[model samples]
Target: MNRRLFLAAFPAVLAAGCGFKLRRFEDIPFASLYIDAPHGGAVAQRIRSALTSSKQTRLAASAGEAEAVLVLGPEARSKVILSLSGAGRVTEYRLGLQLTYRISDKDGRTLAAAEVIELSRDITYDDTQVLAKAAEEQLLYRDMEDSAARRIMRRLQSIGPGPAS
Candidate 1:
């Protein structure tokens, strides 16, 4: 291409690049969200806490008036990996949590589904270190759930029946 044509096209390309935009949080009318999960386990608590901490949606007490319901299926699995010692005996353990989640509207229409959000961390053999590692893993799982919530929000905003800006 000639320099003149290149320069003329370059401005259009830049304009096109800068024209791309994503819907902001205010564009969605999701005032609050209801999260359904048993609270006895750490993973469940993490899931609840993640939703509550989200900037996108306020945490609601129930699904009655919520714009969305985050239903946590179950504490699917807690996988334990036994690392072998030099003599082939168990030396250390790594624990992992896998969770499935789905978001639905107040009318029970499915909005978005995430089958698995897996989080894990390794722990030493010592009891004290094990407790610390467990806490760290819990935090990691919370972070994973938070990321999943953000993804759900983006999906919902993209494909939902909510009013567009």
Candidate 2:
């Protein structure tokens, strides 16, 4: 019994000894930020939530007071039919999200060039399970938003202590 317990704990001990740590929000460059985006936008909300969750960041009241400002421009969502059944019923769909983002300093100096991030997923659909499929699609979009938020955080984290302007 003791041998079995030791065997189960051995791998964990080795992993800990190897200095493995869960990913965390690194010390991002700017301490405060302002987000410029349309109201009720899903992507913007996700990004805002992510930035606020980090203990090192503060949401500025305006662009003038911020060390870094994130400008979120046009965003789009599209569902494209990827496959159809024999009766011409949709069997698969590709849900896509396109978001354009850029970051600048309080002095209006561009810190990061404008870039577009596109995320898409192929989902199998069944006409018989419309309700379940709809729920699945919503979940997928939320997952994509979370992923995009994480990607944006990485971009910010990549900027070390640098000149604000």
Candidate 3:
């Protein structure tokens, strides 16, 4: 194909390809959006890392630069069966992890209400064998937290300051 023909077809090919679009949570940084939580834990750390600009603080403090706040609620609960022996007796144990979270605006308006995000994953009775499963569970938990954070971000974006004139 000649250069002229290639160039002419390139535009069409690009157009035919999947039309990509990007969405941003907000025009302003997260630091500009204030956040408050009951506890400053791992999830809180992740939230700070993911935010555009973050100021880690407890629930009591007020965010002067922020327009919103995120308040974490009660922890969620769940159970997971570890293992079963051939004799039918419960050889292994069980474990669970709980999650609770919430988000709101600085005006005390609940932009995103509080809710629980709980998960249950298993580990075998054997010490070495259980390590892999534990790792997997950790990954799964991380993913869950990431997903929840993204959801909150999207929600905040939806409730944005309105279209820029």
Candidate 4:
């Protein structure tokens, strides 16, 4: 029993000695931030929900009221046929989501340069399961949006406050 216990705990002890730690959410620097994106957009909505849950930065109702403004460029989504069946039917498709964003202070000084985050997922398709495949495509797009939101949050955490004007 003692040997079995030691063996079970050995990995944990080794990890602790090596300082292995799980990643935790880092706080955003701004007290409040305004997101400039189209209303009811998927990525924007995900970002807003995340920030609200984090409670690190308040979401400003307007750009004028925030310490910093995050401007999101138009979101573009695409679906391309990556592979086709021998009969020329669609066998697989690659779905993509692209979004560009920049951060600036209330004074309009750029804090972070405009950057694009693009994500794609390849999905197999079968004509017999049209409804299921369509549902899968939507789920993939939603997953991509969630990932983009996390990336945006990380980018925001990396931005330090700009010099006082």
Candidate 5:
């Protein structure tokens, strides 16, 4: 029992000693923000999840009620053939997601103008594994959405909470 306990604690101690820690989002100046994305927007949903994780930020009831407004444009997703077999069957494809957004004050003054973030992943597909490839594609899309949201958060952090003059 003692040996098992020490074994479990060893890695934790090493990580602590080496200063290994999880990445933490930077502090934002605003306490609340409104996400102005259309319903069923995947990128918006991901951004909302990230903001909710941070106790410092909260979603306002409406754009007018928030100190800051994040305007999210439509998200576009595409799959392009990256490679084809001699028989003209797609062997590899590049899956992509593009998201656009802007930040502004409640008064409609733009802080960060329209910015687009894109993410892509190359996947090899096999006709024999259609179901598996479909699942993989779904996972890739989810990853892209999460990545795009994180990028937007980093951009916002860099711009700070100050309004653009």
Candidate 6:
């Protein structure tokens, strides 16, 4: 029994000795940030929720009050048929979500250039389950939106303080 316990503890001890640490959210460089996106937009809401949870930066009420402004451009969603059944009915669909964004200082100096993040997922569909498939489609889009928000957060984390012009 003691031997088994020693064996089980060895890996943990080794990891600790090697300074291994779990990956976690990093701190944002800006003290306060303003997200310029539609208030009711799903992706924007997700990003706001993530920023709030991080506690690294405060959300500014307006662009003028922020140290940096995050401008979110138009978001686009698309669904295209990737495959079809013998009867010409839809068999599979490729769903895509694209968002454009940039980061700038209150003085309008670009901290990060404009970039686009695009995500896509494929789902098999059945005509017999129209309602169920529709629900699943919505779920997939929600997942994609959440993913985009996380990606944006990661990008934000990578940005360092730029010279104020």
Listed in order, each prediction's TM-score against the native is 0.55, 0.88, 0.57, 0.84, 0.89, 0.83
**Model 1: how far residue 117 lies from native, Å:** 2.1
Writing each residue's lDDT as its tens digit, candidate 1 over 1-165 gives: 699999999988987889865533333446777878766644446545554555666777789878878787666445465687676655576666666777778888777755566666565554447677667666665565555555545555665543332
* C-alpha lDDT (0 to 100) for residue 27 of candidate 4: 83
lDDT of each: 0.63, 0.84, 0.56, 0.90, 0.87, 0.89
Q: Let me know the TM-score candidate 1 reaches against the reference structure.
A: 0.55
Q: How many residue pairs clash per model?
A: 0, 0, 2, 0, 0, 0
lDDT of 5 at 103: 95
Candidate with better TM-score, 2 vs 3: 2
Q: What ranges in model 6 sit over 4 Å off?
A: 1-24
Q: Write the per-residue lDDT of candidate 3 for residues 82-152, one digit (tens) a residue.
A: 67778765545544556666655565666566666655545455545667766765676666566666665
> Model 2, range 1-165, lDDT digits (tens) per residue?
999999999999999999999876676777788998878778788877766777678889999988888898766888999999999999999998888888888888888888899999999999899999999999988888777777777888886534722
Encode model 4's per-residue lDDT on 57-135: one tens digit a residue.
8999999899899999888999999999889999999999999999999888899989999999999999999999999
Give me the candidate number with maximum TM-score.
5
lDDT agreement of model 5 with the native: 0.87
Query: Could you tell me which residue pairs clash in candidate 6?
Result: none
When 4 and 5 are scored with lDDT, the better candidate is: 4
Give the winner by lDDT: 2 or 3. Answer: 2
The 10-residue segment with the lowest total lDDT in model 3? 52-61
**Among these predicted structures, which one has the highest lDDT?**
4
Candidate 5 lDDT by residue in tens digits, 100-124: 8999988888878998888899999
